[model samples]
Target: MSQALARLPGLGPRSARRAVLYLMKKRENALRPLLSALQTVAEKLSTCSICGNVDTSDPCSICTDPRRDEKSLCVVEEVSDLWALDRSRLFPGRYHVLGGRLSALDGVRPEDLTIDQLVRRVSAGGIDEVVLAMNATLEGQTTAHYVAERLEGFPIRLSQLAHGLPVGGELDYLDEGTLAQALRARRPIA
Candidate 1:
């Protein structure tokens, strides 16, 4: 069990062992409920076909919400970034999760992401702005540029998360206040 838990993203062997022991000691109040929740999620969770968000419902609530700003779209490198932006409550726009960034060394390309689908979404009309909310990494910047080129001349404004964020900052790691300020001060790209 400890080894299994350690396979999860940030967990180490020692931490996982401690966590497993803790859960076992609190089985009734924690482990059972956690198991039930995990089972439920595994049974019901699905990726939103439109935005790549994980949700019980297709298209996800954000894509279906009538209150969202249909004329603006936030493009993210992954669903975690979408959740980070949502946590900030700074953007009312819909989202388009790109799955991952372009990485030449890793052989990831524009085709590996949802760039074509994003262009198609924008081309469908009503998108006045497209916010590039990728991480502040070289791959992220490269992917953003490729996307911007794909979206050029589409009439929609293109922008990115503003300065103040460190060079390698990621939206998922930023506080709500910082995220809000970045969104408020976003700059145009093309």
Candidate 2:
């Protein structure tokens, strides 16, 4: 159990061991509930066929929601990114998960992602905007560029997430690339 916990992200062997010991001590309160929850999730969890979001249903709650804006789509590199954006309740549109970014070193290619599915979704009409909410990494940028190229001439506005300083960030602590992007994307204050 410790080894399995250690294999999870951000959990070291020592931490996993401590967690196992704690769970052992609180088996009735923690372990049983955790095991039951895990079993339920394993039994009911499924991937959304349209957007690739994981949920209890095949289409996912977001995809099936009638109140969601169908004319706007937010394309993200992973389901986690989609969840993060949705939790903010800012974008009222649907989403498309690319599964991963384009990384030549990691052998991730356009074909490996759901780019074709995205193109098909756009080609089907009603989508007016596609927000490429990829990460600032090189692979993410490459994937965004590639997807933009694929989505060319689709009569949809292709946009990207602005790369700049964070909400409460100190400029002095930022990297050169972020500063450059912030400068390039500078806008007149309204």
lDDT of all predictions, in order shown?
0.91, 0.94
Off by over 4 Å in 2: none
lDDT of 1 by residue, 10-110 (tens): 99999999999999999999999999999999999999998899999997999899999889999999999999989977899899999999998999988
Clashes of each: 0, 0
Residue 179 deviation, candidate 1, in Å? 19
How close is each model in CA RMSD to the real structure?
Answer: 6.3, 1.2
What's each prediction's TM-score? 0.83, 0.95
lDDT of candidate 1 at residue 88, scale 0 to 100:
79
What is the alpha-carbon lDDT for the whole of candidate 2? Answer: 0.94
lDDT of 2 at 10: 100
lDDT of 1: 0.91
